[model samples]
Target: MQDEPRPDELIKAVADFLRDQIAPQISGHAAFKLRVGINALDLVTRQLALSADSDAEELASLKTLLGKDGTLVDLNSDLAERIASGVVDLSTPGVKDHLWRTTLAKLAVDQPNYASYRREMQGSESKEAASS
Candidate 1:
């Protein structure tokens, strides 16, 4: 379809250029806006790279929790109904873990460098090691 420097690579290159070159050279509101733009580009690049794996994992988790198969929107609706009706909840087996992992997956795509996300990731790894 397309050529070498793929979409994600192109997006990353633009964001990196803004962050490493333009942003540092600018000042005042322009600098702030430039950084914001760069962050948005970076987030898009991360999403393009990570969304497939995260969506697959999320779908699998939803299937396991709901005990059925459907599109992501359908499964999400089912999960919402179950939560709303008190049929299942965080206390229910697998629900909390599924929710946490899903949240982490989302954070990885939207804000991988976020401090709280990094902390939670380390905590999860430690918990897994302990359980194993």
Candidate 2:
């Protein structure tokens, strides 16, 4: 595989440039669009940085929670069906934890700065320690 800067770094750099340099030079509708573009780039950077581990952990959680293996999409579909049919619910062991972890992982990539996400994360370390 290739090295240096990497895709995430490259995206972050462009986003930084847009936010710090370009945004200030524009106004009105163009400025609004530029901010949107920067936000999109930032999101791509977060996804590139976080999705690999997030997906792997999510896959593991699904396998253990469902007692089977499949593509993430397929496993998630099965989980959804089971949930809809009342075959699986929060009362199931690991179901709530798996859903919580999955939601946290997604929020980390989608909007890490969100206030509730920050509050949830502040308690995460203690919760992990307690569980351990």
Candidate 3:
């Protein structure tokens, strides 16, 4: 909608300034708090950069798996209800893969550096490479 510096870019610039400039000038509790703030900004930037596509993918997957259409929230609730009622489970085709993809997408935004997430991503890449 706007010009060159998009929301994610602006957030990253602010985070970079905080990490590179302000952080070194602070100490103790304030420094820790500044680091937290920078981390939050970085997470927000990742969400802005990644969530749209991930959400769309998730919605499509949900629609296909559940064989119905609705807003994402409503579809997710429907799926949850079905799963709780034993109508859907891991044995259901696509459920396991859908869950894996959705979790990976969330982790990419929330905890890209998490050890388990890294391992899972590596595993996925290996599987893709092997398939190719």
Candidate 4:
């Protein structure tokens, strides 16, 4: 497989592309357009980190917010990459609606293969799942 593009390069390219090619063509004349432009750049930077590494520790740490099984539910790497590439509209007002909360709940009991440690968790109970 080929090496993935660095997230920083992707972010910079996105910013440059938007600034030089897209921003000029935007119809808005308001100062907020510039603010929106800056926000897009910042958002792109923030998104890039999501694909840098697996967020296992972050998921583990979020057990409280996520509930017992939520941490074990694996993140969709494709979703992470898309988010990093700005292909997913996470900045949209209703973006949270797309979260996989229900899947987490189901995984807490079924421990689907989509779980972070599916092979390890097989034939295990919730207590064993935690250690996995």
Clash counts for the predictions, in order: 0, 0, 0, 0
Candidate 4 residue-pair clash tally: 0
The best candidate by TM-score is 3
Provide the overall lDDT of each model, using Cα atoms, as 2-decimal numbers. 0.91, 0.94, 0.97, 0.52
What is the C-alpha RMSD, rounded to one decimal, of candidate 4? 17.3
Candidate 1 deviant stretches above 4 angstroms: 125-132
Residue 114 accuracy (lDDT) in model 2: 99
lDDT of 4: 0.52
TM-score of each: 0.88, 0.93, 0.94, 0.31
Residue 106 CA displacement from its true place in model 2, Å: 0.1
Better of 1 and 2 by TM-score: 2
* Candidate 3 weakest lDDT stretch, 10 residues: 1-10
Q: List, residue by residue over 109-130, the lDDT tens digit for candidate 3.
A: 9999999999989998999999
User: Lowest summed-lDDT stretch of 10 residues in model 4?
Assistant: 64-73
lDDT of 1 by residue, 16-127 (tens): 8888888878999999899889889988999999999999999999999889999988998999899999999989999999888889999999888899999988998999
